[model samples]
Target: MSRITTVFDKLRQQNRKALIPFITAGDPEPALMVPLMHELVKAGADILELGVPFSDPMADGPTIQRSSERALKYGVGLKDVLSMVEEFRKDDTGTPVVLMGYANPVEAMGYETFAARAKASGIDGVLTVDYPPEESEEWVEHLNRQQIDAIFLLSPTTPQARVEQVAKMAQGYVYYVSLKGVTGAANLDLRDVADKLIRLRSRIPIPIGVGFGIRDSMAAKAVAELADAVVVGSRIIEEIENSAKENILTNVYRLVRSLRSAIDEAGSKH
Candidate 1:
């Protein structure tokens, strides 16, 4: 099985919800990236979503936007991010890593070229925020050819037809955006999202992972009760930014472990 499938399958077998953590590549420093990844995995992340810094991240909020800016200031590009993945694969190969970002960098590198390089670098999937399903057919084809997943997002406001379009094209798991707005915006109704998932599950074969505006253990547990996976980005990013001075790895480890426990509690109820 592919790394992504394996992780999801394991969670399914155990009747558990996956905990996906997102972190910007080269944040704090490029050198800290690998160690941070390792820390996340050790703390109980089922899957890792690494954000590639982009100049214009339209869907990101102020926190993620700042993270991208900091990463970019350090001269972190797509190639550098992929290089980190290559190095990460040398020792740690079990955790599924999905590259999440905007598409301009990939377009600059060429779709085919980017897919090939991503596969070679041991990346399992890609999620370009701005690339809708209609414009992603070619990119999807290229990624499939390279054995990489083309992950797409489905928002709360997405119509049935558009949901089907994304389901057909999406590989691995589908990212269900909890709200219509950017990453850190407020107002996510878990019960409403659950209803949407019920509708989408009828047509989509893959599991659904919900993200955005999930702030605490209560919220994480609430979503995990309904969705196949609970994704936490802004919350964890906030923890990192707040506690990096005291001890970066230690703080991240504690936070991830706490989130893991929350997910575990919800997963065990099923």
Candidate 2:
């Protein structure tokens, strides 16, 4: 089984929710990327969503957009992110790492080439924000050949027809964007999310991970009550962006640990 499937299965057995934390691969700097990944794992992240820095990231809000800008300032690209993953694999081999970014870089690298290199670098999944399920058959085929999960995004606005499409093509888990706006927007209604998830669950057989607008432990805990996973991005990037160079890892670890504890509390209730 793919690392992602294995991890989710294991979590299911333990009645625990997966905590997937996101970070731009070369955010603070390329050198800190691998270490930051390790720190996240140490702080109880079940899976890591590593962002590839792109010049144009339309789905991301200002917090994550700033993260991409900082990483791009050092000229970090798709290959550089893959290399960082390779370096990370030297010490840790089991944690699933999902590449979360736009389709432009993957298309530029070619799907076949990108899939092969991603497999070689120990990637477990890919979440290309712009690759709608309708247009990703070949893309899914390439990753399937490499035994890597092709993750997809489903938003509140996603239709039932598209949900069925994603259910057929998607591996790993489906990311449900809880809010209608970009990554950092707020005012998430748990009742709305709960209602949507009930409808999505009937169509999607795979696990659902809720993200976007989940900024604190309270939000994470609430989402964890209804979803198999809770994905936190902008909040973590904001933690990195606001921390001092020397204290970045420490601060992020503390924040993620709190999230972990909160999610676990919800899981225990379940």
Candidate 3:
């Protein structure tokens, strides 16, 4: 089984919700990227979503946008992010790492090449923000050949027909963008999210993870109540943005630990 499937299966067997945290790989600096990834796992992350910094990240809000900018300033590219993952695997081998980014970089590197390098570097999944499911046949085919999960995004406005299309192609898990707005937007209605998941789950056999505006432990716990996984991104980047270089790892670890604790508390009831 793929690392992602194995992790989700293990979570299901343990009756625990997955705590998946996202970080823009090479953010803060290339030197700290691998360490940050390891720290996230240490802090109780069941899976890691590592962002490949893109120039035009339209789906991302200010926090993630700034993260990409910082990483790009140091000339970090897709290859650099993959290298970081490889370095990360030298010490930790089990945690699943999903690359979250735009499609341009992948297109530049070529899908077949990206798939090969990604699989070689210990990547388990890929979520390209703009790669709609309908047009991803060849893209998905390549990842499938490499055994890498091609995760897709589903928003509140997505239609049933589109959802079905995504379900047919998406592997790993489908990311449900809780808010209609970009990554950091607020006003997340848990009931609304729960309602959507109920319908999507009927069509999608894979696990559903809700992200966007999930900024704290309470929000994480609430999402964990209904979704198979709770994805925290902007909030963690906010943590990274606020902390000093020396304290970034510690601060992020503590925040993720609290989130994991809260999610696990909710999972125990199920």
Candidate 4:
């Protein structure tokens, strides 16, 4: 099995749900990234999503967009993000690291080169928000050849046929958007979201992870009861944004640990 598959299998065996925390690689500062990553793992993050800063992040909310902008100002490019991951993997081989970003930079880097560089840098998987399943066959084949999982996102609005196609193509967990809008939105309905995820679970073989509108421990715990994993982005970014550079690591550790325990408790109740 792939590294991602193995990780999910272990979580399943323990009756636990994965807690994925997202961070822009160079947000706040690039020098602080490795320390932040270590703190996240120390606080019980099952998987880490290292976001690459893009010029136009269409899927991200205001918080992540500002974080990406901060990263860009620091000259955090794709190569820099890979270097951060390379440094992170020197000590952390157990935790799966997935790069989440847009396709514009990947295309600019050339598909084959991007795939090779990502694998060589010890990245386990990638989630390109704008890459549709039908249009991703070639890139998916390239990444698969390099032993890297090509993860995909499925929204509540995704049609049944496309959901099945994405499930068949997705190598890692399927990212199920909890709502039909951008990240950090309000008024999320757990019952309606659970029903949508149940429909997806009936069709997909891979683990399903819920994101978007999951801002606090309570929301994360609720989502964990139904999905295999819970992903938090904007809230973490908000923490980083609100804190000074010296305190960013400490804040992230505390926040991630709280969410981790919350999800674990939710899973236990199930």
Candidate 5:
């Protein structure tokens, strides 16, 4: 099985929800990327969603956009992010790493070449924001050949027809954007999310992870009760954005650790 499938299976057996944390691969600086990844694992992240810096990240809000800007200021690209993953694999081999970014970089590198390098870097999954399920058959084929999971996103606006298509093509897990707006937007209604998930679950056989407006432990705990996984990005980026250079890793570790504890608490109730 792929590493992502294995991890999700293991979590299912343990009656635990997976905690997937996201951070731009080269944010702050390229040198600090691997260390931040290790710190997240140490703080109880089940999977790492590493963002590839791009010039125009339409789906991301200001917090994550700023993060991309910082990483890009240092000229970090797709190859650099993959290299960071390669370096990270030198010490840790089991944790699944998913590349989350726009499709431009992947297209620029070519799907075949990108899949090969991603597999070489020990990447377990890819979440290209703009690759709709209808247009991703070839993309999914390449990743399938490389044994990499092709993750997809489903928002509140996603139609049932598209949900069925994603169910057929998406591996790993389906990311359900908890709200309608961009990454850092506010006003998440748990009732709305719960209702949407009930409908999605009937069509999607894979696990569903909810993200976008989850910004605190209370929110994470509430989400953990309703989804198979909890994905926190903007909140973590906010933590990174507010921390000092020397304390970035420490602060992020503390924040993620709190999220872990909260998620575990919710899991125990389950």
Candidate 6:
């Protein structure tokens, strides 16, 4: 099994959901990236999604946009991100690292080359926001050949047919955008999320991770009750944005610890 599948299987047996945390690579500061990644795992993150800084992050909100901008200012590109992952692997080989970003950088690096480099760097998954399943056949093939999961996104507006298409092509877990808008959009409406998850569960066989609007422990716990994982990005980015460099690690750790506690409570109830 892939590292992702193995982690999900273990979580299932323990009746606990995954806590997947995202951080823009080289955000806050380029020198802090690897340390921050290790801190997240220590803070109870099951899977880690490292955002690749892009010039125009269409899917991200202002918080993450700023993060990408900060990283870009430091000249942190795909290779730098991959090097970070390689450094992270020196200490952590168990936790899966998923690269979350746009398609432009990958295209520049080329699919096969990117996949080969990603695998060598110990990356376990890739979730390109703009890569639709209809056009991802060869891309998915390339990553699959490298034994890296090509993860996909499913929003509330995704058609049923497309969900099935994604189910066929995607590996690891499916990311369900809990809100209709971009990342950090508010008004979660767990009732709507629950209803949608019922349909998604009927379609997607692998684990489902809910994100986009889960900004606090309450929403994280509620979504944890329904999905296989809870992915928190923007709120964490906001934490990074406001904290002093010396305290960013501690502040983020505390936030994730609280969310982890809430999600664990939900699993106990489950």
Q: Which stretches of candidate 6 lie over 4 Å from their true place?
A: 268-270
Clashing pairs in 3: none
In TM-score terms, candidate 4 sits at: 0.98
**How far is 70's C-alpha from truth in model 5 (Å)?**
0.3
Worst 10 residues of 4 by lDDT: 261-270
lDDT of 3 by residue, 84-194 (tens): 999999999999999999999999999999999999999999999888977799999999999999999998999999899889888999999998898978889888998
Error of 5 at 80 (Å): 0.3
**Per-residue lDDT of candidate 6, residues 77-144 (tens digit):** 99999999999999999999999999999999999899999999999999999998878899999999
RMSD of 1: 1.3
- Error (Å) of candidate 2 at residue 123 is 0.5
User: How many steric overlaps are in each model, in order?
Assistant: 0, 0, 0, 0, 0, 0
Across residues 1-270, which tens digit of lDDT does each residue of candidate 4 receive? 777888899988899999999999999889999989999999998899999999999998899999999999999999999999999999988899999999999999999999999999999999999998878989999999899999999988898988988888988899999997887787678998888987888899999989999999999999999999899999999999998878888888899999998998994433
lDDT of 5 at 145: 91
Model 2 C-alpha lDDT per residue in residues 94-161, reported as the tens digit of each score: 99999999999999999999999999999999999999887899999999999999999998898888
Q: Evaluated with lDDT, which candidate comes out highest?
A: 6
What's model 5's TM-score?
A: 0.98
Q: Tell me, what's the RMSD of every candidate?
A: 1.3, 1.1, 1.1, 1.1, 1.1, 1.0
- Residues 210-242 of candidate 5: C-alpha lDDT, one tens digit per residue: 999899999999899889899999899898889
Candidate that beats the other on TM-score, 1 or 6, i.e. the better one: 6
Clash-forming residue pairs, model 2: none
